[model samples]
Each structure stands twice: as structure tokens, then as C-alpha cells.
Target: MAKYLDSNKVYRALAFIDPYGMTVNWESIQALKGLGIDFWILVPTGLGVSRLLKNDGNISEAWQRKLEKFLGLDRQYIIDYFYQRRSVSTLFGEETQINKEKDIVTKIGNLYTERLKTVFEYVSESFVMKNSTNSIMYHFMMATNNHSGLKIANDVIKPKYKL
Candidate 1:
């Protein structure tokens, strides 16, 4: 990413980590700033699955409604869609889940409020892109949806805080 945009003199970059923002490590942010990006915005979009169908049972109706509202998806039309998922390991079995309501919302907010380390460095450039018309509210919505998953990841990456 830096190589391609470097030549263009694009001094700054904004990576859409997930519509549900990302766990930003300020330490890494300082490092990336050294790479010449004056600033970067983590405009997260929960989980993108444009290749798949529209409706998905794993996701809830309210989740669908919120995602549609954020992504400009029409409410009248329903279709299978994708949202980031997580796994909960138990003594008996592991559960794969997507927490669209309360869980997702906070995982997204931690990007700004909480500080992480390695999670900040991995770009997943294959998945990141630039938004021509970026808005804070939109990014907030995205972050809210991913909050739960991000919190799980945050805990895994920073396990010292775990209960």
C-alpha cells in the first residue's frame, strides 16, 4: 500500500479496516506516521460480503436494519448479508457467533478509547480501501456493529485484561 501510493505523493492514507472501526495501537500509529501519512482515519465497515447473497440467518433482523441504514441498503428489500463473526471456546464445544447488537457496538468504539498493539500494524490491504466521501457518523455506525467482535479480538490480543 505504501509503495503504490508513495510514488503518487499521497502523504496520508485512510484504511477502512472494518465498518466497525479497528483496534488502533497508538504506538503503531506513531510508526505509520513516520511512514509519511500526516493522518489516517480508521473508517471501519463491519464485514463486507458483496460476493454473497443478501439474507443470512446468523444475523438478526435488527442487525439487518442497522446495517442497511449504515450502508445505504434499502429497508424494503431484504437479502442475505454478511457481518463479522467470532468464536467462543467452551469446555464442551466452541460456538461461532455474530453479536450485532450490544456486543458489536462496543468492540468498535475501543478503536479510539482503548489502545492495542499488534492489531494496529496488520493492514489487510487486500480488504482496505479509500472512501471518497467519508463521514464520522457512518464510521461510528460501522464501529458500533463490530464492537463485540473487536472486543473479543482485543481481549485475545491483550489477554492480561481478561477475567
Candidate 2:
């Protein structure tokens, strides 16, 4: 789809909204950003973060294979994804160990927030939407090139998804 947009010369500042932000390739995202394509990514917070960290006893071999493929890495990267230090080290230059579930949730949120800041010129926390079944509110990040696009996204799109 990015290739199609590029071929047709469509550069009117588009947005890609997705729940699986972790699965997205940052390199491809950078290429699309060069073409004025912004990204609104949903960060799985609360229980979702715990599930991902623990693998939830539901991750099958097939699911692991799919995750590996999505992340474009081998098994070691998958291990690192689950076991790596989850902290605000990049921003604060100090690593705080995450030992509890609440700490893990906070760390995941901080990590993604930092990632959005690192990748985009303008980043905003659009809103949080609650999951009906689990009753967990997941945070969303809106990454854009300029303030106008961020305004449009926050004023228009953000309200629609507000819980």
C-alpha cells in the first residue's frame, strides 16, 4: 500500500492507524514518514502488557513464529523483547528496575512514549480507550510531521475514539 501511494504521487499527509505498533518495522515507518505519512499507534497497556511480558501461557509455537516474522528477527530478539530492561533509561540516562506488574506497565508506557518522540518531529498522546472485556484503558500515540496534522488528529480523530 505504501508503494502504491508512492507510485501514484500521493503525498497529502496520510495516517496509518494500527494496534500492533510493536510489530511494525521502524525502517519502513521512516520511509513512509519521508512521504508525509503519519502513524497513530495503540500501546497495549495494563493487562495487555502483562500478557505480553509473561506470554500468558497462550503463546503457541505458531504464534511465536508469527511474532518472530512480524518483528523481522530470530529467536534471540524475541527473548530480548520479553526480558530486556523496561525502563526510562533512554530519556533519563538512569535505569529503574521493573519488578512488579505496575512497574512493568509504567515501563512499557514510557518506552513507547520515548520511541514516538525519537521517531517523529511531533508526538502526542491522543487518548485512551477502554477494552470492554478487560476494562483496561490502552493509550494511543499520534506521531506526525507538523502541528497542523497533530491538531487535526487530536481534534477530529481522537474524540471519536475516546471512551
Candidate 3:
């Protein structure tokens, strides 16, 4: 896309990025900023991010690196955003325990939307997609420099599925 943008020809593109999981790098999306592109991305909030976030907040180094690369945020910031650190008195002593936040899927979606807002002029409401067991698996969101594109995305995203 950056290559095409450098060309003299005027081009408007509509891109749908549906990764199998949380494999897409943040730099790829950042490259689309200020370009004439309408993008719809499938964020695996539940299937990927939420699952990677362990309940005890003791994520492995590899998983932490993956999250940081995908979300473009610091590991500590991501941990703090998704978990609450509380001091609990154990039988031996006071221990700091990190508890995962409630409704992580929504939080992940909101966080992604906020990140998208940093690059796009207009970001449409998310369309939540659930799995067969009714668990939230992904969020389909559209980002564009044009307001009309946002409106069209809103129109296409059903009310019930809006997040």
C-alpha cells in the first residue's frame, strides 16, 4: 500500500484484513494512515488477545512480545489495562495478586478502536461476532478517512451486533 501511495496515479482502496489470529503487526495498519483507504479489520479479541491474557497476569515472554507487537503497546501497559493489581493478605504475608478485568472482549475491542482513532479520521462502530457457543470471538471494525465510508459501515453493521 505504501508503494501504491507513492505512485502518481490516484487510487482509492477498500481493504479487509482478516487475520487467522492476532498475527497482524501494528506497523502494517499504521502504514495505512492518512491514505485513501477504507479498511475493515477483524480483531480476534476473544479468540486471541483475551485468551493470551492469563487470569493471574503471568503471561509468558513470548506471548507478551506477541501482544506488544500486535497492539503496538508496552507489555506493562497492556497488563495494567487488562488486570487490576490488588494486595491480598495470604496466610504467610501480604501478596500482590493481579485479577483479570471483567468483560475483556469489550475492553479489547474498545482499546483497538481507540488505537484506530489515532490513525483514521473516522472509525465506525464495531460489529461483534460471536462463536457457536455465543462467546464473543471477534470484532469487525471499519476505519476510513471519509465520513461517508464510516456511515456506510455503520449502515452495514446491524444494530444488534454493534459494539
Candidate 4:
């Protein structure tokens, strides 16, 4: 998997080929392992960038950089976003418009999820991968930049601490 990773956009990608070979997914999985993580909290699990590239025929550089930043952020917020989130309530806070926007974000995310499912079949699509994931770890961040949720989260979090 290291070979696949080497060609991707991750700035400092790492993978272990010892004892049993490691895909960085190990780190993410560990984060969610025993924290009573429920589906509602984490919603769409997995990294969100490189993984989503295949489906996005013409990705914008801005979007690419955004996901890179998301990966760079600690997974602590990810788990916290879900399991400990008062997130939804705060956003949909007695506001019909917020509810409407929330619904739209959900639908968009589902579309991305469907697109991501077949990414492996098109691994060859990336100019970098060039049909090489058959033997390497690619840090495909499959997480969406779900701006709606992110904004809500940022707002909710700021109240607990200064922005």
C-alpha cells in the first residue's frame, strides 16, 4: 500500500509493512473502536479526499486542499463531532431554514457515498495511481467536506471556548 500512498497528495504519508502491514486506516479505526460510537454520530466513516477523487471527474484544487486540512485535523474532533455533538440540535435550533439546509447536506453526502463505493474499480483513473493500488496504501480521504455540518460544528464548539 505504501506504493499507492507515495503517489497521492498526502504531505507526510506513512504506512507500516511489519508484522502484518498497516494502512493508516489503523489509526482512524483505533479512534472509533471502543468509544460507544454510534452511526448517527460518525455518519459516513473513513477518510474523505483521495477516496472521493475517482468519482469527482473534475475536482477543484480548493476542495482538495480543504480535505487535506480535514485529515490534518485530529480525529478527536471527528469522534467528538458525532458521539458528543449537540451539533444537530444547535443548528436546527427552532429554525426551519436550518432544518432545510441540514436535509440538503444529508442528501449531498449520500450521493458522495454512492460515488465512493466504486472508487477501487476506477483506481486507475487517477493520474498518480496509474492502476497501482493493487499493491499499496493510498490515503484516500473519503470524508466529505460537509460544509453544512462543519459550520454547525464550528459554531457549537466556539461557545465552549473562544473561536
Best-performing candidate as measured by lDDT: 3
- Model 2 TM: 0.53
Give the runs in model 4 whose Cα sits over 4 Å from its true position: 1-30, 39-56, 68-163
How well is each residue in 48-156 modelled by candidate 1, as lDDT tens digits? 3221223233445655555454333454332322243579898879987653333332333333333222223222111123245431122221111123434543443
Every candidate's lDDT: 0.36, 0.57, 0.90, 0.29
lDDT of 4 by residue, 1-163 (tens): 3343333434222222221212223234333321211111122222233333333133366554443343333334322322221233445474221111222223334433344333211111111111233322222222212334334434432435332
TM-score computed on alpha carbons, candidate 1: 0.23
- Residue 23 accuracy (lDDT) in model 3: 83
Error of 1 at 124 (Å): 20
Best by TM-score: 3
Quantify how close model 4 is to the true structure by its C-alpha RMSD in Å. Answer: 19.7
Please list all clashing residue pairs in model 2, or write none if there are none.
none
lDDT of 1: 0.36
Deviating ranges (above 4 Å) for candidate 1 = 1-34, 42-103, 111-136, 139-163
Q: Write the residue-wise lDDT of candidate 3 on 55-125 in tens digits.
A: 99999999999999999999889998999989999999999988999999999999999999998999999
